[model samples]
Each structure stands twice: as structure tokens, then as C-alpha cells.
Target: METRHLTYPDTPDAYPSVMVLGFFDGVHKGHQAVISHAKRVAAEHNLPVTVVTFDPHPKQVLSNKPDAVRYITPLSRKLKRIEALGVERCLVLTFTKELAGLSPQQFVDDYLIGAGAVHVTAGFDYSYGKFGEGTMETLPYHARDQFTTSIVTEQTRRGEKVSSTRIRKLLAEGQVDEAHELLGAPYVICGEVIHGDARGRTIGFPTANVLMDASYVMPRLGVYATRVKLQDGRTFYAMTNVGRRPTFYETGAVSVESHLFDFSEDLYGQVIEIEWIQFIRNERAFDGLDALVAQLKQDEVSARSILS
Candidate 1:
């Protein structure tokens, strides 16, 4: 897909394309429905589908706290998901205070019309412009018959709406299996391996300490059954711990340590994706090294069963 980093107040794109608009944080099932409809509309009209998204999230800038916002799919992962859905182009607009201050008419003129929107598709609840005053309902009024609009309604499963907020809540509760159901895939966190205290090595369970990207919404502090995919594409079953090692040190630093079953290679500086399959157990301080070791052995057995 052709990706463009667009700045505001620039010249309108000459290419007439079908535009899909949203923050599209996780690109969850609801978001997927909207994009899929855009793809279909683009196919019918013989035009490219341009997905318009924002960076740093409007919430981070608009809210009082900048760091309070976390993402289910960071910009990189969101782009990847959009590309996989057969989008033709993606416009990453840098969200700033200036952009957020635009009026509803200004938003339509710049984003939809300016970006060459022949048709627009977004979710029912999708909103834009100052304080989200511009919504799917207002798009047609602002479009002035220049383009058609489509709004995909809420997507739900098992009588519950599938949403980023719901998924985040599930992850926060260490309910990875339920999160997986809402996401329509395994919940993934990709990161680079970094150095740790190397205490797990001394205890016969060497781990890769992953330093995750800053903006990801990490799963709750606990053990999980996961599959780790290395940079080169090899996959392994893993028992991952997200906790402070209280057995070794009192109120230790929180860490993400994954022990790859049947593999013991130094992975410092390498990137890997961890796909969480199930929540094994909550993190707790063990009696000692021996007790922790025994629990780890059980964790491995549980992880192997779940990952299998």
C-alpha cells in the first residue's frame, strides 16, 4: 500500500479515491467492518481506498494528561492491519492542537474533500472535528453532494459490542482469551529483547526480557500462555511472566520475561512478537526460589497444553 504522511492546509490530492476515516486504534471488528465496506465501495467505483488516521491519538493531545492514552494497536501495527485488509493507501495525519481546533466544515473540506474523497465510509459512532462535534450524521451535510457516505453500525458478538475499550478492559483483567475473541485474533505485543538481572538463568529458566513500545496497553500483571514469534519467523510455545520478582527481591521492578520452551538462545537486541493465548494465573510472591521453581514448572505444563 502507498503510505503518505500528510500535513494540514496542503493542496488537495488530485487522486479521487474512496476515503475511510477513523482513529482506528485497534482496528477491531467494528473498525474492520467499516474498512471492508470502504474496500467494497472502492472496488465498485474503480477507485483506490485511502484510510485516513491520526498519530499520537487526538485524546492524548486533547486531554489534560498526555501519557494517559494507550493504544491497543500502535500506529505501526494499525497500519499493518489496514494493509492486510487490502487498502490501497494510508494517510497518517499528525494530530496536533491546531488540527483539533478545526470546525466541522473545515474538517470535511480538508480531510474528505482535500484528500480526494469520492466516497466516505466510517463506523456509526465515528466522529471528527472540534471536540468530536462532527459525526457520521454530519458527514453528508458537510459533503455537499460532492461524495457519498456509508456508516457501518456497531459490530457485536455474543450480545456484547466489540470495541477497543472492551478489549482493553479484558486485557487489564488478564482475560486474554476473551480479548482474543473480541480482537478476532491473538492479542499481540511486539518488542525488543533487553538485558535483565539474569536471575532466571541461574534458576534454570532463562528468559528474554522484552522492552515493549511505550504506547501499548499491556496485559495485566500475571502469567500467560503465549506463543513467541522471532524476527526470522520461528514460533515457540512460551510461559510469560509480567510481574515484579518478589521471590528474589522485595517489591522488585515489573518486567516481561518469557521462557521459550525447548529453546535457549541469547536473544539480546532482537525483536519478537508475543501472541497471548490464555491467562494462566495471577502474579504473587512465592515463599522462595524453590517454590517459584515449582510454580514455573506447572506454568510450563499449563502453557504447553493451552498453546497446543
Candidate 2:
């Protein structure tokens, strides 16, 4: 897939490709549906499928706490998901202060049209430009005879709108099972494995310690059934904990540590991805090392059962 960091200065040579625009934070089912429609439309028109997304999400810029609302999928992961949908090109625009101030019509003329969009696809609630002034209401006037717009309806699963916000709430509350259903896949956290105290190793179950990206929302404090992917691309069934080491009296610093079932290898510094499948138990303070080890063994059993 072609990745372009586009701006008004450099416009596309082509003038009629299908475009899908959104924050696409998780590229969740709803976002995917819009992209799917755009891809199909693009295919029919024999045009390249392009997705326009912005970095440093608008919420981060406009909200009170720029740091508090942790995103589900960061830019790198978002791009990867978009590419997986077979999008021909991805335009990742830097969401600068000036860019955010553009009027609705200016955004359409200078960005959408300049980017060569002959057709556009967006979610029912998608909006653009300064103060979110651009809506489905404004597309026709600006594009004139050159553009066609399709608003993909909301996607639902189990009677709820499949949305990034809902998924984030589910993860925050540790509702892994429900979250997975909305996400249309397991909820995953990917990061680099780092050296910990090796306390789990001393106990019997060796674990790969992962340092999660601070900008991403984490699942609730609990043990979860998970699948871990190594940097070398090996995947393993694993039991993961997303919590402070309460059993060891550690607090404040939350961690993600996983014990790969039936496997062992040196993993320090390697990037690992763990998908949370089911919440097994809440984090607790064990009486001692032996007690902690015993509980972990039980966690392993529960995780294995769920995964199997």
C-alpha cells in the first residue's frame, strides 16, 4: 500500500479516486464498513482506493486533557489495519493547529478536491475542518459536479453500535468478551518486551514483560487469556496480566506480563503483541510468593481452557 504524508502544497496527479475519511482510530467495524464501501466504489470506477486520516487525533488537540483520552489504535497500528483492508493508498495528514482551523468549504476544496477525490465515503457522523463545521450537509455544494458522497450507516453488533468509544469503554471496564464482539476480533496490546524482576521465573512460570504504549487504552486490571505474537512472527497461546503486581505489593506502575504456554525463549527487547480474549480474574495481593505462584498456575489453567 502507498503511504503519503500529504498537504495542500502537494496535490495528487489523479483527480477522481474514491476517498474515505475518518479518524479511524481503531479501524473498527464501523470504520471498516466505510472503507469497504469506498473500496468497492473505487473498484467499480477503476480508481485507486484512498483513505484520508489525521494524526495527533483532533480530540487530542481540542479536548481538555490531551493526554487522558488514550486511543485504541495509534497511528502505526491504524495504518497497518487500513493497509490490511487492501486500500491502495493512505494519506496521513499532520493535524496541525492551522489545519484544524480551516473552514468546511476550504477543507473540501483544498484537501479533499486537491487530493483528487472524485467520490467520498464517510460514517454517518463523520465531520471535518474547524469546529467540525463540515458535515454530510456541505459536501455537494463544495464538490459541485466533481464529487459524489456516500455516508455509510452505523455498524452494529449484538444490538449496539460498533464504535471505538464503546470498545474503549469495554476495555476500561475489563469487559473483554463483550469488547471482542464489538471489535470483531480480540482486543490486543502490542509493545516491546522488557526485563522485569524475573519474579515469575523464580516462581516457575517465566513471563515476558511488556511495556505498553502510554497513549493506548489498556484493559482493566486483571488476568486474561491471550495470544502473543513475537517480533520474529511466532504466535503463542499465553496468559497475560494487565495490572500492577499487587501480589508483590507493587503499586501505581501497571504492567503487561505474559507466560507463553508450552513455550520459552529469550524475549527481552523483542516486540510482542498480546490479544486479550477473556478476563480470568482481578488482580489481588497474594499472601506470599508461593501463593502468587499457585494463583498463576490456576490462571494458566483457566486461560488454557478458554483458549482451547
Candidate 3:
């Protein structure tokens, strides 16, 4: 898939295109429905499929206070997942103060028009430009003479709306299985394996320490059954922890560490992707190293049983 950093001045090449527009935080089932519709439209019209999304989510820029929720996916991961949907091109618009100041009409004229898109597909609740001045209700009329528009309806699973926000809420509440069902896949965090204190090595279970991308929503602190994917794309059953090293009296930043079951290798500096499958237990401050190690053994047993 081709990716572009779209700006006001840059226009798409001259071609009939169908575009999918939204923040697409988790690319959950709802977002997928929008993309799926866009793809079908593109196929019927014989136009290239393009996906347009903004960076730093509009919420981040529009927040008056500092406590707005963090993002669920970084631009890289967002684009990767969207591309996996078989879109031909992904245009990542860098949202800035200047860009946000444009009126809804100005935004459509500048970005959507610039993309040469004749058909645009988005969710029913999608809004854009200058304090959300443009909503789905207002967009089709604004584009009446310009292009075709389709507002995809909400997608629901188990009677609940499938959405990035809903998935994040589930993850934060430690309902990973429910989140996965909404996401249509397991929740995975990809990051580089950084060096830690090497304490796991001393305990005979050397682990790879992963520093996760801040943009990705982390699940509730706990030990989880996970599938670890290496840079080479090999996957393995694993047990992962998300917490401070309480047994060693360490108290600062929470870390994610994974012990790949029955695997031994030097993984320093490697990028590892962890697919969280199931939650095991909440993080706790164990009494000593032996206690922690003993609990980890139990965790591995539970993880293996669950995964197998």
C-alpha cells in the first residue's frame, strides 16, 4: 500500500477515487464496516481505494485540559491495519493548529477535493473541521454538487456498538476477550525489546523487555496469556507481565516483560509484537523473588493451558 503525508497544498493524482475517512483508532468492527463499504464502492466504480485519517486525533488538539484519553493506535499501526484491509493507498493527514482552523467546507475542499475522490465513505457519527463544525448530517449537502457520499451505519456485536472507544474501555477494564471480539482480532502491542535489569536471567527465565508505543492503549496491569511475534514474524506462546518489579522493590515506571515459553534466545534490540490472548491475574506486589518466580510458574501453566 502507498502512504502519503497529505497537506493542504498537496493534491492527489488525477483519478476517480473512493476514500475512507476517520480517526480509525482501533480499526474495530465499525471502522471495518466503513472501509468494507468503501472498498465495495471503489470496486463498483472501478476507482482506486484511498483511506484518509488524521494524526494526533482531533481530541488531542481540541482538548482544553490535559486529561483527555490517550490514543489506541499510533499512526504507524493505524496505517498498517488499514492497509491490511486491502486499501490501495493510505493518506495520513498531519493535523495542526492551522489545519484545524479551517471550516468544514474548507476542509472538504482542501483535503477531500484535493484527493480527487468522487466517493467518500465514513461512519454515521464522523465529524470534521474547526471544532467539529461539520458533521455527517451536514457533509452530504455540502458535497451535493461535488461528490458522492456514503455514511456507514454502526456495527454491533453482542448488542453493543463496536467502536475504538468501546474496545479501549474494555481493555482498560480488563475485558480483553470482549475487546478482541469487537476488534475482530486479538489486541497486540508492537515495540522494541530494550534491555532491562537482567533479573529474569538470574532466575533462569530470561525475558525480553518491550517498551511499548505510547500511542497504543495498554491493557489493565496484569499477567496475561500472550502470543509473541518476532521481527522475523515467528510467533510463540508466552506469558507477559505489565507492572513494576514489586518483588525487587522497584517502583517507578511500569514495564511489559514477556517470557517466551520453552524458547531461549538473545532478543536485545529486537522488535517484538505481543498479542494478548487472555488475562490471568491482576498485578500485585509479591513478597520475594521466590514468591514471584513461583507465581510466574503458575502463570505459565495457566497460560499454556488456555492457549493450547
Best by TM-score: 1
| Residue 258 lDDT, candidate 1, scale 0-100 | 96
Clash count of each predicted structure: 0, 0, 0
Clashing pairs in model 2, backbone N/Cα/C closer than 3 A: none
Report the Cα lDDT for residue 222, model 2. Answer: 87
Q: Per-residue lDDT for 1-308 in model 3, tens only?
A: 99988665555564569988898988888988999999899999888888888887766766785345566667887788898999998888877777889889888887887668798889999988888889988888767567889899878887888888788899998788888888889988888999999999898778899998776788998889999999888899998888887777667788999999989888889998999899999988888788888988899899999999
Off by over 4 Å in 1: none
lDDT of each: 0.89, 0.85, 0.85
Model 3 segments more than 4 A misplaced: 9-11, 64-69
Best-performing candidate as measured by lDDT: 1
- For model 2, the run of ten residues with the poorest summed lDDT: 7-16
Backbone clashes in model 3, listed as residue pairs = none
RMSD of 2: 1.5
| Model 3 root mean square deviation, Cα atoms | 1.7
lDDT of 3 at 292: 80
TM-scores, one per candidate = 0.97, 0.96, 0.94
Put down candidate 1 lDDT per residue, 145-225, tens digits, no spaces: 889998898899889888999999999999989988877788898999999989999989999999988789989999999
Q: Cα RMSDs of all predictions?
A: 1.2, 1.5, 1.7
